[model samples]
Target chain A: MKDTTAHIVEVCPRDGLQNERRVVATEDKIALIHRLIAAGARRIEATGFVHPGRVPQMADAEAVLAGIGPHPGVALIGLVLNRRGVERAVATGALDEVNYVVPLTDSFGKANQGQTTAESLAALPVVRSMAADAGLRTTVTVAVAYGCPYEGDVPVARLREAVRAIADTGPDEVAVADTIGCAVPADVTSRLRAVREVCALPLRTHFHQTRLTALGNVHAAMLEGVTVHDASAGGIGGCPFAPGAGGNAATEDLAWLLHRGGHTTGVDVDAVTRAGRWICDVLGVPPRSAMAHAGPFPTSHPPRGPG
Target chain B: MKDTTAHIVEVCPRDGLQNERRVVATEDKIALIHRLIAAGARRIEATGFVHPGRVPQMADAEAVLAGIGPHPGVALIGLVLNRRGVERAVATGALDEVNYVVPLTDSFGKANQGQTTAESLAALPVVRSMAADAGLRTTVTVAVAYGCPYEGDVPVARLREAVRAIADTGPDEVAVADTIGCAVPADVTSRLRAVREVCALPLRTHFHQTRLTALGNVHAAMLEGVTVHDASAGGIGGCPFAPGAGGNAATEDLAWLLHRGGHTTGVDVDAVTRAGRWICDVLGVPPRSAMAHAGPFPTSHPPRGPG
Candidate 1:
């Protein structure tokens, strides 16, 4: 038997490409989603339904979803910001899950969704009911769960209250997101522990690699019994609202870390790397994943025979 | 009271620069070492005394040492490969410590030092005694302690025997090194445990980030009660003999991880980044450290005011 297993959500096609400067072709996005599934990614955030003017890169969401072939045992998720976005995701008829964001701070909520935090909280149950009626599993992510760009050092009380509010909405899983990559491992440990105290739902962690602490924080979260994580291929993805924030934790790097730490992800490292390199080639950007540049481990070199 | 503390040896000036294609000016090398000291690096590997023809990048060892201004608490170390190299280090009178490598495989030994593993082991005590008589501290690193290029997956018993041999010389510390960055956290845990059983010397870990497991391995070492770690500024340095190996663990990244985990390493993150960026500028390469690219955490941004 494998040591222990965890669920990893490859967010490359949706979260990763949403923030990129170049708009990838619809065919390329579908290809990436397929590759991610082939690499043992059972769940993927395939696309986001936002305004084209807002995120032109994700404007081809419907066409991309149409091109993606359903794979057995894989959940293709589409991100929705409001009721209209939820309708768009449901209309696609391709997504198995619809993910929504619950911005913890009012400033972030107004900036991102043009609604107040209280309003968004009130709307959570409605969105969940709609998605549930559509026969789609729903996930709600608490953005800036650790600290906020608009409000530095979000108090534990505020985060607990937010988790408690989201918990009442009855989402399948609530993601504690570091939207700006500002969290350290200790912060992750304490914050996730706090979330666990108030939340009965399965926990998911979304970390950004802006400060190079994403992997370290992932290790901490694993220690805290967080089995679900969000990562991107080639380390792509950043919050358009969070200034100077870098990419999500690279999928290949996270998979390698998890495997090395005696946890089973069932993700193929080589397949993930190949997908990462391919996407980088598409975007004309360097592959940000360290494993991509460093090549495979136990590099095949013939040992010098008996000397 | 502070949390746990770990000692990190900045090896940029020696191990990092030794592999650079461009030879840094002696003044620049001295400046970089000074910057490291200012960043709370109490122990630094300042230079390597190898044949100038073999490693032209380190040809200015004497000039570089002469240019360094002493910091009160710093221990400047010089790396030497042979007895003659030891003499050269002692003659410089700048290094507080002389570090030697005891290769565990004959293939690596012959390729690196032009000597067999047995010959290097026999010469270890002689070099230590010479450094001891010269009133300099000594450290012997068991290179390829985890895995080797010429011989893949070095047996733990071979490592135990090598450590036992080095232990007999009574060196201050023995670094269990992953010369090719091939180690996983389990490998580090088991191998370090094996080395501890055979050698009572304080253990140090030298890891290359070629496979992106260095920080994870560092966390494992800390759990095993091994506190000393070797890192480089901007993640520079790769073993010339170890093909496909990347740079050493980036010093800034290690310091950030340690600090975030509530461990103290007196090194200032900004100062280390400054040194890292400066060296990268000199080398005409992009800074390899992720933190360097991400900039400092708690990034200052004005909050969107209440509407």
Candidate 2:
């Protein structure tokens, strides 16, 4: 088997908690971030600086960021919706990166960012400069790069243009976000290939399990030479706009996949699974991750033979 | 853009209905096979001719086979567990090919076929001759090809040896079945590569969506040069003994994927989704396919607005 190196970015703290209508206490967020860093998440999307009035679940974002330890090797990232979001994110010295999302389709863009795709992308340059001045890297994510929930499939030529536009801005990475989980393996391979043709920047994929095909998309991208995969801690993600959209690919499952597929994920599946269990407590619901349901890897008590 | 072709085999009437726990009306089974055949199913596993005492599900196998309408493009196949199963299937005169399963793990074999892996495999040669004498091409399937529920991960060498032994009997096609849906894209790729090293026969894959990774495995295998895939309609299949295992990869979703990924599946995805709705009526659950829930192709629906 050929060796494929893979990286998993933990997004539970952000994507997982972002959609929860119920408010989460700051202490729990702090403890969760600490536990994630301990579980081998080098780059964690710590939180978003969205308006508290809009996302009450994330009302204590600043407090949550202040509470986390600045451990070495664990670079923290924060999601910024626009210039104001970036301004707040830059104020957090703990943040090493600020992620700005630009949608491939104008409708999805407007639905997600409350602006046209062009307007949202136009803000990228400003956010990049602010992030640069703050000594933080910028990553431009092309939301629904593979397919759109409202607009359907985005043409490859258009997506290439999207990647080129973002890559030209000279961000650290250009990612394709499967916001509604509409991507298949071919979409993953071909889209990655298309983006790679225009730019040399590393590609990150954010896949949702809406259609239960995101992990497959991850495998396809990895084959096409992508290394970074974005997953929530317990397969937690959903569009506030798209009601039935499923959760993002679970980090524990993705880590297990990369490790079991002979790729070095440098993640302990058990630790991630534990994180999934803990966060599920915060949500007060059963986790959406299949891996979390299967029990931890190398189950503590060995199978006493099959039932 | 290059045209990458992925082979899809329809398993609706067999894998789809086998676990119904209630015998489907003979006419309904026949209608499904006809529709699946019309949907560009070149190879369809129509039924399993096993003892009615055990699988009372196969009780109407002969009647269903007799009801199949003429379709030149369709190749109807039957799944046979043993020689008696083979004899009953051959008597149907409706099958163009036969698939014989030899599970890799002892527990899965007993649970699936009521015999140990060794005992089941020992009957392969006899079943091989029986099919050959009936002028039917036989495809050998090794269930739990990727990972077994009872056993964690079977060594690749063990898989290779099993395939080689089955190949020695001169089966036309040798397929590895991810019976319990434990296969990832990478595992599918490497294991298929290993099997290719030892056997020069046509390769096929059967996948279940237990962990929702089956379609990714299909895409990875197709990239690794596998054209044929097995899927159940409405995402149905589970071992009587292997509890918690999911159904086969949803045929409708796989067809939707191939069509979206720019492959020729000859099946109308919307029509397949309708069939999924039909099966869900029988199962009293919504179709498990994500695309089924997402609705038909983006193009099929009309004018919401321009993006």
Candidate 3:
């Protein structure tokens, strides 16, 4: 299990900068995506197609995507919330995939996308069909799949029902998101187990470092055969709707953890650390990544087996 | 495994404050211990018996222990580095246990205590005997057991050999310390397995959260049947000798992880979080604990499953 390869989906450009008070320059967002790609991130959440008034940080999504241009073997992902978001994302022809969020609880669903859980479920097929018709990939992310800030714990049975509904929509994959970062390793194992029982879609996990269990959750998920995980450079970003939520699991940190655990992430931990530091500098915030500050293991010397 | 009970040995006063640049007042240290006790810490590393000039923060070890006095159910632990430390700790008559440090590498052992790995190993039996004769419990902590900043990776065979030697000394329990915080979950699993092969003694683990893998390592250790773990309040603590080592795993954060995983820790997460915040305030540093800032999982309303 430890020797298997894992895929990291970089979310610094979209989810990482979404809730920042200061909107970053579109060029910088493009630069961050380029850096992430250079650091071996094949799948990147480039931007989001949401209300500009609601999330000003991602207002220049189209321009930012335009600035990134194209790269072979790299998949650009755009986050979509509703019908308008889906339309905006498909109209741009820049993204390889569109990620639609379906909140598990009504409170977060309404707060995040002005829709109820059932409404989001109803919109899934339409969202998937729109991207599918446009020759783009589609992934449905169940938001707050572990626990919700507003509605507390989302039961495993509810999650199973949600995943069953999502599987019916026929998206390319399913993602379970710890939107409020309130999950432990046990939660990851049980919830992923439940989701797997209901759907055969390739599973991805998105965790936040809110309670400092992100890496633990990632490890547990990996043990359960979850190969794809979401992380942000510098551990930046939080949901504006979820109070007290911290940054996402850091890219460099997760890469370091995976690499050290004998899992190949194909990520240059040093390069990702530099990119994390660079993006944090642009945001005028200290990097929330431990690898950014401490560097990779055996910082100064190459590791030598005991003498 | 998730349904078991775990023991947390609070190390905020000794390891937590020992590395701070500013020396905290002895009364404040006692108050911090009292707060931890009130927060349901049964075992506490109250202070270290080392040279005053070397670790100025722990200069008032006797004073701090004297002030803490006696509590029937709580076991006070004093960290000892050598024969002098052991003698000093026993003389104080306040400590119920004396934890001896034995570095896995000569570089760290020399840098930390002016002794080589062999020298520390040679002194362990004597140290253990001195404490045992004084009616004090003995625990041997192998420092840098995972990876060393100065000496890089400490091989598992080397760890097994060291544990074998320490086991011959007949300490009450053996501890593996990731002194530099370079360990991942696999490292914890592998190292603990190696140590268990050599010794039938009870096992404990100490992890630092420098690269944010501490909680994952803790979870891995728990799965390996290690019920005893060390943590510091507010995630305060690092080795002064370790160049880039960060704080120990935060007590409140660890408690939250254990409790959420259905493990009983006999800790009040909210109280420990408050204590963590209070100590950080005293040190004029921000609390490194996630729970200190984000509160617990169900931060607001009581958890209503699926509703």
Q: Rank the candidates by TM-score, best first.
A: 3, 1, 2
**Could you give candidate 3's per-residue lDDT for residues A173-250 as a string of tens digits?**
999999989999988988999899989989999999999999989999998999999999899989988877899999
lDDT of 3 by residue, B195-241 (tens): 99999999999999999999999999998999899999999999988
Quality class of the docking in candidate 1, CAPRI style: acceptable
Q: Report every candidate's CA lDDT.
A: 0.85, 0.80, 0.91
User: Which portions of model 1 show Cα errors greater than 4 Å?
Assistant: A301-307, B300-307
> By TM-score, how accurate is candidate 1?
0.92
Tens-digit lDDT string for candidate 2 (B186-230): 788789999999999999999887777888888887777787898
List pairs with backbone clashes in candidate 3. Answer: none
Q: How many clashes in each structure? A: 0, 2, 0
> Predictions ranked by DockQ, top down?
3, 1, 2
Candidate 2, superposed: residue stretches over 4 Å from native: A242-244, A295-307, B1-5, B38-40, B67-72, B114-118, B296-299, B302-307
For model 1 the interface RMSD, in Å, equals 4.3
**CA-based DockQ, model 2:** 0.39
lDDT of 2 by residue, A59-125 (tens): 7888888889669888899988799998899886879999898888888776666777788878888
Which 10-residue window of candidate 2 chain B scores lowest in summed lDDT? B298-307
Which of 1 and 2 is the better model by lDDT? Answer: 1
Top lDDT model: 3
Q: Flag clash pairs in model 1.
A: none
Task: Rank the models by lDDT, top first.
Answer: 3, 1, 2
